[model samples]
Target: MGNKNISMAVIRRLPKYYRYLADLLAKDIQRISSKELSEIIGFTASQIRQDLNNFGGFGQQGYGYNVEALHREIAKILGLDKKYKAILVGSGNLGQALTNYSGFKNAGFDIMAVFDANPRMIGLKIRDYEIMDSDLIESFVSENNVEIAILCIPKEGAQQVADRLVKSGIKGIWNFAPVDLDVPSSVIVESVNLTESLFTLSYLMKDGEEA
Candidate 1:
């Protein structure tokens, strides 16, 4: 199957495999069998083999997977090599925290600029980039060729801002707003609803305690 045809479950697992392989590489380990990797990441050997095989099977039959090689392959599949440009909107607590995260840049989603609707926040600097007025988002996105937008705006205004982002040619949005956004079918929006996630975690913890 082509990469585009890969299942979402397999796609989601790619980052896990990439992270574990990176750890092994950092520890100076050169190779790992599927069975060994499964033990480390809590996946079945067959599952690991099957998932990697979907992308042409990086592992050899006898020698197993080369850690660095497999990591590079997974990172390629995840588009970490592209260093996609992104912009952050709504420079509140969540937005600032996301801007402060170095992992996003390390993983190739570089936030080129930050913006806020608040006049007080517009001139503030986060890290190296100055926060600009949200009014300038369209022109900034156009000039920068930004592929993704990170939205940390309030729910009430999320849809309007998302519409503007879509109009400005952003292909993807990483939304942290409480409400869902309505965008074109061609535009992908990944919403991170922190409250819902916390509730789910609470449920899991309660179940574990009862068990």
Candidate 2:
């Protein structure tokens, strides 16, 4: 199927499917039918089938999907096998937490360098790499093959830093800043709005109480 044809809703569910499939594989679960998988993930059987079908059908009519095989296919779809060389652009609490997250590597995002504007944080080591000066971002990116940038900087400085990253040849930006960013069409930006998600949870809880 063409990229334009696929709904964002389906795209958003990809990671959930990938994680659940990985869990199944870990448990040595050999195979799973759509209905059984739906029971586990809370999606309907037809919904799961439709989502998987969008990327080319992996399951058969009589038989089910092979857990390992399905997991591998989803991993391929998510580009988990290709470990992307990435840089982190903040050194504060959120930045430090993200730097310590080993799951990013397992999911194919390799954060090689951490950058901060703070002079005090420049020399500090987080995980394996020392935090570098944010001023050096343009030059460092120019010198290295940096594919993705993790934006953990404050909202006030995010746009400027993102501009530098885009100019320095970073194609993807995983933005954790509170404010929304305006980037060019070529540069992909995925914003993780923590506050928005929290508010959404609150709304859901209130709605449940009313129901």
Candidate 3:
């Protein structure tokens, strides 16, 4: 039951699985044993088996799982199986780069709306979606039924944007600002800091690596 629950925790590692699986699938690799997968993913064979056993386990007593099946199963579990509509906040460099990024749309997530208050940018288009006035967020999101929000505002504005997002009926937020947010517990917020990761990599390169 614990292993089953851990497998349910699998959502946290979907990106790793997706990346590794995509590589294997591209290589035309079909089936793989738990031990082999463990070697590939740096997990222990037992851990791999336990994690996979929850929703997908295919190894024969002696063989292993069919890689393709496991790949699709993980994709489905991560909500990547369906197209996700997203709204982006801010029209600054960081936000524009993401809107121009082809990968977000290609990877089953689409930036359907971009918002900003800057008059110069409000009518500009990025990745096919013109920037809209931030004041219209609630109406735009409600009318379009937006499910995801990508926040690219300044740190000082993080909590405020989060508050607005929660009120806008957004289900998930991918926050890019360097700040902690406070909102109703019902909303999901995912924050990523590129500067921290880059500095961490540099630190590791200068010294050794740290977990």
How should the candidates be ordered by TM-score, best one leading?
2, 1, 3
- Overall lDDT per candidate, in order of appearance: 0.93, 0.91, 0.82
Measured against the true structure, the TM-scores of the candidates, in listed sequence, are 0.95, 0.95, 0.87
Indicate the TM-score of model 3: 0.87
Instruction: Write one digit per residue (lDDT tens) for candidate 3, span 1-211.
Output: 2233554356566678668888999999988888887898897889777766665565576868777887888887677889988999999999999888999888889888899978899898876888899999888888888999999989888788788878879889998998878867778788898889999989988786444
lDDT of 2 by residue, 59-113 (tens): 9988989888888898887778787999999999999999999988877788889
Better of 1 and 3 by lDDT: 1
Which has the better TM-score: candidate 1, or candidate 3? 1
lDDT ranking, best first? 1, 2, 3
Error of 3 at 69 (Å): 0.8
User: How far in Å is the alpha carbon of 205 misplaced in model 2?
Assistant: 3.1
**lDDT measured at residue 25 in model 1 versus the true structure, 0 to 100:** 95
User: Which segments of model 2 are wrong by more than 4 Å?
Assistant: 209-211
Which residue pairs clash within candidate 3? 59-64
Q: How far out, in Å, is residue 133 in model 3?
A: 1.0
Q: When superposed on Cα atoms, how far off is each prediction in RMSD? A: 1.4, 1.4, 3.1
